[model samples]
Target chain A: MNPTACLLVIGNEILSGRTQDVNVQYIARRLSETGITLSEVRIIPDIRAVIVRTVTEARAAYDNVFTTGGIGPTHDDITSACVAESFGVPWVHHAETFRLLEAHFAPGEFNAARQRMATMPQGAVPIRNSVSVAPGFSMGNVHVMAGVPRIMRAMFEEVLPTLPHGTPVTSRAWHATGLYEGALAAPLEAIQNHYPTIDIGSYPYRLDETQRGVCLLCKGTDAQAVSAAATAVRDMIARLGFEPYEGEPAKS
Target chain B: MNPTACLLVIGNEILSGRTQDVNVQYIARRLSETGITLSEVRIIPDIRAVIVRTVTEARAAYDNVFTTGGIGPTHDDITSACVAESFGVPWVHHAETFRLLEAHFAPGEFNAARQRMATMPQGAVPIRNSVSVAPGFSMGNVHVMAGVPRIMRAMFEEVLPTLPHGTPVTSRAWHATGLYEGALAAPLEAIQNHYPTIDIGSYPYRLDETQRGVCLLCKGTDAQAVSAAATAVRDMIARLGFEPYEGEPAKS
Candidate 1:
């Protein structure tokens, strides 16, 4: 079984629709590549109680929990405090983080609010940020990072090497035009039952006025099983009196 | 106070980083415009127990709950069944839905799996889909819609008219260059305290190597208060020895 993970995106901007979150997808793809199964993703607001509760629950349920956003140098940024409260640990100002922030900013720029970014839960190790000076921290299994895409990506790169990896999932897709999902569902279910370990997904897409069809994808940890399922899916599509093309359907 | 809502995005493809969800943001923006506060968004896989648990919790916590995805004619499509189980109601084929699907498809095309799309929780009202014939449903406060962006949007537009709306949120943004968030944080906090009703957010952006600054936004139900807070934010930026722009800073 793959090591499971959950991503908690803490941002009011995301919930308010002021921002389209790129962090979740970026982290999800990276986690998939790293062989960690990203089982769940929650996009929550900057509420302290909610954040703490979610962090507590995710940490207990998943092998690793990643939280993005609410770690900025602003009044709305409350992720660090909430994380500390969740762990029942005292929030402390990390000496190395303080030094880094102090050096990154001008003398007058390093004010009290910016200093808040240096604060983390006790026993937490810092996740270095290449884009921004303020570092994200890892307390227990929960990894906290900035909400900004660039900073989040940088922090993820730094933190990924530290986490445990599982068997990477491999996927193959077959696209078929003039095929209805309802007509395909029964045979697809049979194929899925045949290969119990692999996950087969049938997604119908209407790219434009002219381009529209169903894309069948097979994914699993075992490369051979996944390939076999893909083959079966292709065969099923062919049997359904439609041509099956490798990869995703062309969108014009 | 605005009526609170939570969005449950149900799909494994989204969790796997295969699809960037447009539904949450579209729903969120619409909810904001309609005066409903979108409290949370959970992007979960097509798991029965998890969906049931999440739907149950969201229904209890929020005034309205919207779920998108898995309501299709495929093996992985189990949202309708799960939703029925969540409310402890029998999954039944709605006569109107079956008739609509029957008319939309060819005789042989309306198979058993395709018939699944017509199944919904007992007593649930169907939300008409303009893009596709397969109708989404509304049971209690939970509104279920299709995963496809076009279909989801159409369903939402149909269902939104039926739901109660509140006082819409108003917002104003002030952009400033060469101003640090740390320097702005203290004064922004003071402004937040001054107008407790208004929520002030400080967002820092690095447009390029040459352009970097913070954008301060004031949001609330009161338009006057939001405008007043925006003015104060502009004043704060000016006081910090920077020119405050009326809109977002130019990116080049």
Candidate 2:
């Protein structure tokens, strides 16, 4: 089995329904692209105890953990301190991160407000943030990043080149129009039974106001198994006198 | 402490980044509108064991537990059955629910695919779905609904009127346009100290592409206290000679 990861989305705004959690999807897709399955995602409020407990538990369980949000300059931005507390590490200044912060702001502008970005856990590696000076930090098995979508994506890009690569994640999907799930169940089950390594998923979607179709998605590392299962699905649809369109294959 | 709620978003598609978890934000905001505090949210894969474990734990802890997703006609739509099994109940069709479903779906349209939607655990009350025939079911401590945002929100509307009401959740927000967070830190802490019941939050937003400002938000059941805290924040901003534009007034 490859290394699995978990995401911890921390913010009161998320829980309060004021802000949408964009980081989860951003991280999940990026992790999947790297062949690291995002096993679980837990969203906790900005409470220090809860954040610490969640960080501790996630690090203990998952191969690697990523946390987003609560790293800003606001009073509620306690994720860095909380993560440091969880690891029992002292808050220290990262020389590189400090330089980045200084470069981001004018001489006098880099005051306490901007200095808050430099306070990282002891021995933590700074995750370079290209959009802003407030860099994310990584320690042990946890990689913490900004909550904003652009910043989070940038941080992930910066950190991706440094992490160990795993298996190549691949997927093939075929869409069978005008057919319901029941019509495809038996064939789908047979295909699933034959190719247990390839995960077969049937998503029923309503499109064009009146049309309905089931998009059979096959995902796994084994390309032969994925193609085989997808072929079986297309054959089943053809047998039913329906035109099965193999959707545009995802970018490699 | 008032009654609280938790949302369990069950879908592998969400975790895989194919589908974003919109139900959590909608449910949380809707619950807050009805005075129910949304304390926690968890997103797990469509696996039955994970769903059962998360559902069981959340139901035992929160006052009300609402789950979205996994109630469709596809093979992965196992949330309804798993939820029934978790509560030790047999999934049976209720006469009233069947009638409602029948009324929605014409004669032969309610086939096996649609029939799966009508099946519910024993002693479950049907949540009305204004948009579709696939009605959500509420059994014991858990409410299971569709993953689609529109259907979920409509089902929640029908379900909300039935749950017991709690404290009226209210909020006040004051925007400190383009002011640094450090400038308001001391006064913000004083405001928090003055109003223990109200939770205050500061959000930094980039302005005109350069300067940033912190929006101080005060949220609580007590309108007077929330307003007072907002006023205190506004006064402090004025004393600092920064033009603080009050955003939208307190809302429930």
Candidate 3:
């Protein structure tokens, strides 16, 4: 079975709409490619109790829980403490990380605030990234990651090879212009019912008032099933007097 | 207290990274303006049991619950039935909606699939949008909207005026270039502690290689507290010999 994962985005900025979040899409795509099922994603505030409760729940509910944000040195960055509380352990400064960070900064620059980055739950493993000196850590099934897209991607790269893998999920899609979802729903439904193991989806998109289309996609770990479903989708499109295009339609 | 809200985005497309969601930001910003505190946002797939459970839980937890996606004519469109199950209500065709949709389509064009669009839970109120003939519904405090951005925005606009609004939450921000968050974390924490009613956040951003900075934001229901926090943040920035700009910094 493909291991299920949950992404918990812990921050107030996302909920307040202060910043447009690009991290979810990046992590979601990476998880998909790594053959992990990203079951759910949540964006919550930086409150301590909420973070602790969410981490405890998510850690048990999914095979893996990946968290972003709240790992920095600022006051709002409380993921480390909350995660430790959730695990019923004490937050401690890692000897190696403390030494590395202390040496990286100037004598007086390594103050109390910057030193907080070197702390984590006891027995946690560090997940290093190229973008920042402070490392994100992994405590049991939960992987803490940086919120910035560049840093998060790098940390994910470090964690990817370590995860338990399933067959890599892949997809096949067919698209046709000037088609309405209502007109093709029945046949599409039939195709979906036939492929019980794979997921068949119909996405209706409109580029402009003059341009519209529906893209039918089949996704699964089984390569043959995805391809077969795509064939059926293409055939249905052709039967309705539209030229079926392979893969997603180009956006204009 | 501001009326708390939760936005549940239900679709497989978003989870599979097939779509980059714009709905969350739009809803969050509108809720902020409407004086509703958007406490959480969740993205879950289009499974019936999951939908039913999530909807039921979210409706009870928050004062207002907003949902997007899966209100379509396709086979994956199971939100209507699931929502009804969540509320323990019967899913039935609305007489007016059925009549309007039947009249809109040609005699043979309105098939079983198209008819599903007109179905909703008992005692649900239709949320009309200018973009489409099919209506989204508001069942109690749970407002269901379309997946398409244009349609979703219109549905939200329809629901906006009818919602129970709270005191509008507002923010004041000061951003300065060539500053590190580590340098400001100490003073920022002090400011946050002083204004216990408001939220003070320091966000570190990198613009290319040479440009890196921090944006300090103060947000709350109280305008005076927000303004006071902004003054402290600006003073901190100037003390550190950086010229802080009001609002956000230009990304050039």
Candidate 4:
């Protein structure tokens, strides 16, 4: 079994529909490549109690818990404090982080709010941020990063290399235009049962008038099983009287 | 307090980072318009036990629970069964839904997988799907829809009217180029304290080399309070040295 991970997105903007999340997908793909299974994701508000409970629960449940957002130098950014409380540690200023912040900011620019960015839970190790000077931190299994996509990506890249990895997941897809998922479901299920280790999924797309069909995806840690399942899916699509195409068909 | 809603996104593609979710924003905006407060969102893989636990918990916590994905005629699609189990109801074929499927599919096209789409928890009412024939269902306060963006939107539109609403939230925003969120945090907290009902947020954006700043947002059900908080935020930005512009500055 792959090492499981869960993402906790702490932002009101995402919940308010003001900002569309780009972090989840980026982290998901990266985790997959690192052989970590992205098991679950929770998009919660900046409420202290909620954040604390979620962080604690996720830390216990998954091998790694990644939290994005609410790490900025703002009043609503309470993730660090909540995370500290979750771990029953003091939220204290790290000397190195403070020095970094002091060097990054202009004269008199580093106010109390800005100073908040330098604080983290006791015994937390900082994750380097390439985009911004303020670093994300990791305590135990919980990794905290900025909500901004650029900073989050940089932090993830820096932190991921240090984490343990399992067998990387491999995937193959076959698409068939004019083929309905209903007709393919039974046969697909049979294929899935035959290869219990692999995961087979059918995604039907009908974005435009001309483009409509189902894309069959087979994914697993076993590369050979994935390939075999993909071949079976293609054959099934052909048996249903539709030409099977590799990968998703180009949307016109 | 507004009537609360929680969204449950069930899919492996999303967890795999193969697909970026577009349903959350659409649902969040729609819920805001309908005077429903979107409290939390959880994205879980196509796991039956997890789905059942999440659905049951969400139903108990919020006024309405909306689920997207895992409702298709495929091996990975197990949402309906899980939802039925969550509610402790029998997963039975609805006569009306079966008839609709029968009418939509060609002769012999409605296979066992297609038939799965017609099954729902006992005592569930079907939500109309204008985009596809397979109807989403509403069991009590839980609304199940397709994971596909287009289909999810259609089902949400169909089911939203029946849900109870509260006072609609209104928002105002101000943007300031070269202004740091750290400087604004203290005063912003003061403004938020003054108008306890309003939700004040600072979102920092960095696009390209030159475009970077914080966007201050004031949102509440009270229009006057929202406007007042916006004015205060603008004033604070001006006091700090940068000119505050209404709404988000055009991304350049």
User: Which candidate comes out best when scored by TM-score?
Assistant: 3
Docking quality level of the chain pair in candidate 3: high
Q: What is the docking quality class of candidate 2?
A: medium
Is model 4 an incorrect, acceptable, medium or high docking prediction?
A: high
Q: Candidate 2, which segments miss by more than 4 Å at Cα?
A: A92-114, A248-252, B93-114, B248-252
Candidate 2 at residue A77, lDDT?
84
Per-residue alpha-carbon lDDT of candidate 4 for residues B130-242, written as tens digits (9 for 90 to 100): 78788899999999999988888999999998888998889999999888788788888999899998999999876558778889999989999999999999899999899
User: Which has the better DockQ: candidate 2, or candidate 4?
Assistant: 4
- Candidate 3 clash pair list: none
Give the alpha carbon lDDT tens digit for every residue of B1-252 in model 2. Answer: 667888888887888887767788888787777788888888888788888888888899898999988887666788998888889889887778777767876677666656777888888888877776768989986888888777888988888888887877788787766577766776787788888888898876766566667778889888889899889988988888887787842221
Candidate 1's residue-wise lDDT over A1-252, tens digit each?
A: 889999999987888788887888888888888899999999888888999999999999999999998888788999999999999999999998899888988768788998899999999999986677788989999999988888889999999988889888889999998887988899999999999999899999766796678999999889999999999999999999999999987654
Model 2 Cα lDDT, one tens digit per residue, A1-252: 668888898988898888877788878888878888888998888888989998998999898888888887666789999889999999877788888778878767776756777888998998876686678988988999988777888988888767776876678888877887766775677788999888788877777667877788888878788898889988988998788888732221
DockQ of each: 0.83, 0.54, 0.81, 0.85
- Candidate 4 residues lying further than 4 Å off, grouped into runs, are none
TM-score of 4: 0.98
Model 2 DockQ reads 0.54
